[model samples]
Target: MTERTFDSATSGPIVLGLSLPVGSVRVQVIESLITARVVLHTDDSTGPAADAVNRARSEQNGQVFGIEVPDMPNGVIVRGDRGTVVQSVGNMSFVGGTVRINGRVVSGGMGNMPTVSPIEATVCLPAGSSFGLAGTSADAEVFGYVDRMEFRSVSGDLDADGVRQLTANTTSGDINVGRVTEQITAHSVSGDIEVRLYDGSAATLNTTSGDIEMQATGAASGHVSAHSISGDVRLAGARHLSVSADSVSSRIRR
Candidate 1:
C-alpha cells in the first residue's frame, strides 16, 4: 500500500482524477487536506502487480491533481491538465502515442504485457472540490458534499451522497445518490437508479431495463423526468415538482 497527501489550502478548488482498469475507489470530503491511499489486492505482491503499484505516479498542474497507474502495458493512457482529464483502458490500442501530464511524459510507449491486478483506492479531498474518474469495472463510492462529480464506467456501481451537480454513465451498474441539491443526469443500460432526499430542481434519469426511483425533499419546484423501458418507476415525496415519468412495459407508481 502507498499513501500520498497534498495541501488543499494553497491550490484553491482542487480537481482530483483517478484512472484504473479494475478496482474499487472510495472518495471522502474533508475540511482542508487531501490524501490518497492505494493498495493492490493481489496475492503476488512481489511481481508485476507490485511494480504497477510502485509505478503509480501522482501529478499536479495548478489546481488539477491526478494519479496514474500503468496497470496495463498496452491499451491504457491516462493524462490530465488544468482544464480536462482523459483516461482510457481496455483492449483497444493507440499507436505512436505518448501519455503526458503537464507536458511531462508519464509513459512514453505501451508494451504488449498482460494487465495487472485489481487496485483499491481511498481518496480524501476538501469540501467543494470536484472529482472525475474514468475506469472499467471499478466500483466507486463517494461520501460528503462535492461541488461537481462525473464518472464513466462499465459494470461498476456508483454510490454517492451530497453532490451539487452529478453526471454518471454506466453499463449494467446501479446508481444511487442521496441529498442532491442542484442537478443530476444519469443513464444506465441494465442498472437501477435511486435517489433519496433530493432537493434538486432538475433531474433526468433514464434506464433501458432497470428500475428508476426518486424521492424529493423540501421545496423542490422544478422538473423531474424518469424513463425506463422494461423496469419500474417509483416516485415519492415530490408533490411540489412537475414530474414526467414513463415506462414502456413496466409499472409507474407515484
Candidate 2:
C-alpha cells in the first residue's frame, strides 16, 4: 500500500494509456495540479502465498507508468512487468503536454491465494488532453474534453463523453458516448453502441451481433456509415445527406 506521484510538463497536448486485466478503471479530466493515479493490489498481506506475492508486488508495483521524452516522440505505454506487481496497487505520475497513460493487470497466484477482488484504479488527467485507454474484462469510465480519444476493450463496458474525435473497439460489451464533436470510428463484436453527436463530422460504426444507435443534431452536415450483421441500426436527428446503413436481417431505421 505505497503511493507515489510523478511530475509532468505544464502545457500542451497529453496522451493517456490505461490497461487492466480484471479491475474497473475510472478516468476523470480536470483542471487540476496532478496528472494521474495508479493503484496496484495483490495478496501480499496475509496468506501462505503472501511471501511470494509480496516479492512480486514489490518489484512490479511502481513500474506501471513509463514516460518517454522527445526521443520517442511523446508516448506512454502500459503492460505487465516481469510478473511482480500484477496485483498490488497505488502508483501515480504527473506530466503535461501530450501525456500518455498505460496500465495492465495480469493473472498470478501464491501458495494460499487470497480471495480478494482487485481494487479500482482511478486516474485524473488534465482537461482537454488527448487520451488513450485500454482494458480487458474491466469496465471503464472516462469523462473529459479530449482533443482525440482512443479506447480498446474486451468484454468490458466503456462510457465516455466530451470528445472531439473518437476511435473505439470492444468485444461483448456496450459502448456509450456523449457529445462527440468531430468524428467517430467504433467497432464491436457482440456489444451495443450508442452515441450522441452534437456537431458530427463523420462516423463509421460496425458491429456483428450488437445494435447501433446514434443521434446527431438537426444542423449536422456529417456523413454516417453503419453496418451490422444481425443487429439494428437506428439513427435519429441526423442530416439526410450522405448517410448509409446496412444490416443483414435486423431493422434499419432513420
Candidate 3:
C-alpha cells in the first residue's frame, strides 16, 4: 500500500478524470480539508509474475493531476515483462482545484493468467468544487455540493446527488440523480434513468430500451422533456409545469 498527499491553496474548484479497466470508483466531498490525499493498495499474484507485478506501480503524485499505474508498455514483450496482473483495491486520490484520474489493466501471456482483479477507488474532495469524472466498465458513486459536474461511463451504473448543474452520458448503465438546482442533461443507451428535481429546474432525459422516471416537487414551472424508444416514461407530482413525454411501445404515465 502506498499513500501520497498534496498541499494546495488554490481558490478554484478541482477537476478529476479517471480511467479503469474493470473496477468501481467513488468520489466524495470534504468541507474542512486544505490538502488532497491519494492512496494505492495493490495485491500481486505469486510465482514468476511477483517481481514484475511489484514493478507495475503508479506514477508519482503530481501537483495538478495524477494517475495511478504508469502508462502500459507498447510492445507485447515489454508489457509481459511488467507483469500482466497487478490490481488496486480501495485506491484513493484526493485533489483540489482541478484534478483527473486515469487507469487501465491489460491481460496478456498464455495460460490462464488469473482474471484481472477489479480495482476500486474512493476520492474525497472539497465541497463546492466543480468536477469531471469518467471511466469505462466500472460503477461510480459521486456526491457533494458541487457547482458543476460532468460524468461519463460505459456499462457502469452512476448515482449522483446534490449538484447544481449536471451532464451525464452512459451506455448500458443505469443513472440516478437527485436535486439539481440549474439544469440537467442525461443520455443513456439501454439503461434506466431516474431524476429528481425541485421547482424551476429544467431537465432533458432520454433513453433507449430502458425506463425513464421523474418526480418534481412543489408548484414548479420547470420545463421537462423525456423520451424513450421501447421503455416506459412516468412523471408524477407537482402542478403548473410544462412536460413533454414520448414513448414507442411502452406506456407514458403522468
- Cα lDDT of all candidates, in order? 0.73, 0.62, 0.62
**How well does candidate 2 match the true structure in TM-score terms?**
0.68
* Shift of residue 64 alpha carbon in model 3, Å: 6.9
Lowest-sum lDDT 10-residue window in model 1: 77-86
- Highest TM-score: give the candidate number: 1
Model 1, 136-249: lDDT tens digits are 677789988889988888878889987888999999889999878889999999999999878888999999999999888876769999999999999888877899999999
> Where in model 2 is the C-alpha error above 4 Å?
1-13, 32-114
Candidate 3 CA-lDDT value: 0.62
Sorted by TM-score, highest first, which candidate order results? 1, 3, 2
Question: What lDDT is obtained when candidate 2 is compared to the true structure?
Answer: 0.62
Alpha carbon lDDT at 46, candidate 1: 55
Across 171-250, the per-residue lDDT of candidate 3 in tens digits comes to: 99898877767788889999998877644478888999999987777745678889999999998774456888899999
**In candidate 2, how many Å is residue 123 off?**
1.1
- TM-score of each predicted structure versus truth: 0.76, 0.68, 0.70
Please give the lDDT score at residue 83 for candidate 3.
Answer: 37
lDDT winner among the candidates? 1
